[model samples]
Target chain A: MSAVAAALPLADDALVLSHRLAEWLGHAPELEEELALANISLDLLGQARACYALLGDEDALAYRREEREFRNLQLVEQPNGDFAHTITRQLFFSVWQELLFGRVTGTGPPAAVAAKAVKETAYHRDHAEQWTLRLGDGTEESHRRTQRAVDALWRYTGELFQPLEGLDIAMEPLRRDWRARIGDILARATLTMPEGPDADAWSAGAGRQGVHTESFGRMLAEMQHLHRSHPGAVW
Target chain B: MISLAELGVLRDVRLLDGGRTAEVELTPTYTGCPALEAMAEDIRRALHTADPRLARVSVRTVLSPPWSTDDITEEGRRKLAAAGIAPPRRPGPARGPVPVALAIRCPRCGSTDTELISRFSSTACKALRRCRTCREPFDHVKEV
Candidate 1:
C-alpha cells in the first residue's frame, strides 16, 4: 500500500476512538475520570490530526469522510458499552499502539509522529492497565462486569495482530509480546482470561478495508453533524 | 508585542535582506492547540511593526524535534507560576511501558507534598494536582 493508504487507517483509528472517548465528557463516573478520559480523547485526536495533515486538510479528511471511506479498526468503532467496556477497549488498543509505534519509530513513514505518540501511548496503556487491575480485582460486582467486558471484546483483539501493508515491522513478535504482556496484567488483576479464538483461526475484522460495525455509522453521523451543518464556520 | 518566544512556541527567528524580511519557525506544545494560528498572526503583525519596509514575514511550523515542557525558559516558568499556572517539573527519563508518576512540587507553597488529582486538565499540557500541605487544588504543567 501507499504511504497515504497506510496512514489513513491508523489516522481513522485514532479519530474514531477519540470521538468515542469524547462522549464520556459529562458522563464519566466521576470528575477525575471525566478529565482523564477527555484528555485521552484529546491526545488521540491530536494524533489523528497530525496523521491527516500529511494527506490534506485535517478537518475535511476527518469530518467529510463517509463511513465507507473510513479505515479504522473495528475495535475502535465498537461502542463504549460501559466503564469496564471502555477501559477494556482502551487497554487492548493502547497496548497494540504502544508496541506498534515502538517498532515503527525511526523506520516507518510516520516515524516522527510515532516517536512522540509512543510516549503518549505508553501513558495511555498504563492508565488502562491500572484501571483494569482495579476493576478486575476490586469487588464481586466489579470483577464480574470487567470479566464480561473482557470476554465481549476478545474477538476484536485479533485485528491488532494483522499486518498493515506499508509498515515493515514484523507482526509475529508484536503478537507474541502483546499476549505475554496482557497475560501478565490479567494474572496480576486476578481476572480470568477469556478463551479467545485460536491463533490460526479466522479472525473477524475488516475495518482496515473500510468495513465497519453497524454502530460506526451512527457515531460518524453524530461526529460529522456539526461540521456538515456549518460549512466554513469557525468559533 | 506578544512574546511567542516566552510562550515556548517560537523555535527560531531569522532576519534576511539586511533585516527587511523576517522568518520565524514555531512548534506547538500540543498538536491540536488552537493558539498556533493566533501566534502566527501575532508574529506577522509584530514583524511588520518592527520594520515597516519589511519585504515579507513568513511563519513556518516544524515538528521534527517535538516540543516538551523542558523548552519553557526559566523566565517563562516564572511568568506561568505568577499567572497561577504551575510550571512543569524538569522532565524525567523518557516514557516507557510502565508509566511512573513524578513528584511535582506545589507551585503555591513550594511543598513536595503534591498528589496528582488527574492526569489531564482543561488544557492538553497541564495535569490536575493538589497540594496536601496547603489543601489547595492546582494545575501542574504535564511532562510530555
Candidate 2:
C-alpha cells in the first residue's frame, strides 16, 4: 500500500469523531456548555483538517473522496447516545487521544505547534475525565446509565488498539508507550480496560487498509453533500 | 469616518465581498446571558439605520485570552453599568509588584455584600453571584 493509504485511517478516525462532536453544537442543555462543546469540536476538526491536509489538499482529502474509499472506524461514527453516554464515549476516545497527542508533542511537528496542541488536548482530556467522574459517581440513575454506555461502547473499543498498516513503522514507538500509559489512566478512573473477543496475540485489523463500516457511506454522503452537489463550486 | 481602532480591527482588515453586516465583535462580559441575541440585534438595527448596507450585526464568539473580567473595556464597563450590572472594583495595579484580590460590588443597593453562588453558573464564562444584603442574583464574568 502507498504511504498515504497507510496514514489514512487515523486521520479518518479524527474526522469522523470531529463530525459527531459538531452535532453537539447549539444543542447543549446550557449555553456555556454549547460554547464549550463548540470549542472542543472546532479544535478536533482543526486537528483532523491538519491530518488530512498532510495526506492531500485539505478540501479534497475530506470532501472529494468517495465513501467506501475512506477508512474511519465505526466507534466514532456511532450515534451520540445520551449525556452520560457522550461523556463515557469520550472516555474511550480521550484516553486514546491524550496518549496519542502527548506522545506527538514529544516528537512530531515543529516545537511551537506540538507544544501548543499538547496543552490543548490535555485540557480536552481533563474535561472528559471530569464529566466521566461526575456521571459515573453521581446519583444511582446517573451511575447506572453511565456504566451502560461504557458497556455498549466496549465492543467497539477493540478496534482502537488494532494496528494499522505500517503504523508500527510510521508512528515510532508512541503506540506501544501509549498502551502502557492508557492502561494506568483507565485503571485509575476505576474503569476496566476490556479487550475484543480476539484480544491479544492477534495481528491488527484493516481500517487503514481501506476497510470500513456500512454507515460510512451515509456519513460521507452528508459530509460531502455540498461539495458533491456543486462540483467545482467555490465557497 | 471611523478610526480602524473604532472598527475593532487590527491591521489591514480585509473587506470581503459578502460582508454580512457592520458589527463589532465585542468579547462578552460574561457567558450565557439570554440577552446577547437581543443586544446583537440592537447593534444591528443601529448600524442598519446608519448604513443600509449593514443589514445585520452578529456576535463573533472568540475565546483567546479566554474572555477574562479584565477584558471588559472602559466603554464596555459604562455600558454594563447602564445595563445594570454593578461593576466589580478594579484593584489597583500590582501595587509594589504584588497582585491583590479584587472585590465585586453589588450594582443594586451599592453594598459590598456579595458572594459567589456557583463558579459554573448560567454560563461557563460567568459565575452565579448573589448580593448578600439585597439577595439579587448577578452574573460575574470569570477572572480567566
**Each model's backbone clash number:** 0, 0
Name the candidate that leads on DockQ: 1
Q: Report the lDDT tens digits of candidate 2 across residue range B21-132.
A: 5436643322223344565566556666866665555555332322334545566555555555644356466578676676777766666778865444444444567899
Candidate 1: misplaced stretches above 4 Å? Answer: A1-4, A107-109, A198-205, B1-3, B16-21, B91-102
Q: lDDT (0-100) at residue A142 of candidate 1?
A: 90
Model 1 lDDT, residue B5, Cα:
78
On the 0 to 100 scale, the lDDT of residue A48 in model 2 is 64
For each candidate, the alpha-carbon lDDT, in order, equals: 0.83, 0.58
Error in Å for residue A62 of model 2: 0.8
Candidate 1 C-alpha lDDT tens digits along A1-235 = 6544567878899999999999998899998889889888888888898888888998899999899899888899889998999999999899999999888745444777777777678778988999999999999999988999988888888778778867777899999999889988988999977776723244344787787778999999999999999977786
Model 2 TM-score relative to the real fold: 0.56
Q: Each model's TM-score, in the order given? A: 0.89, 0.56
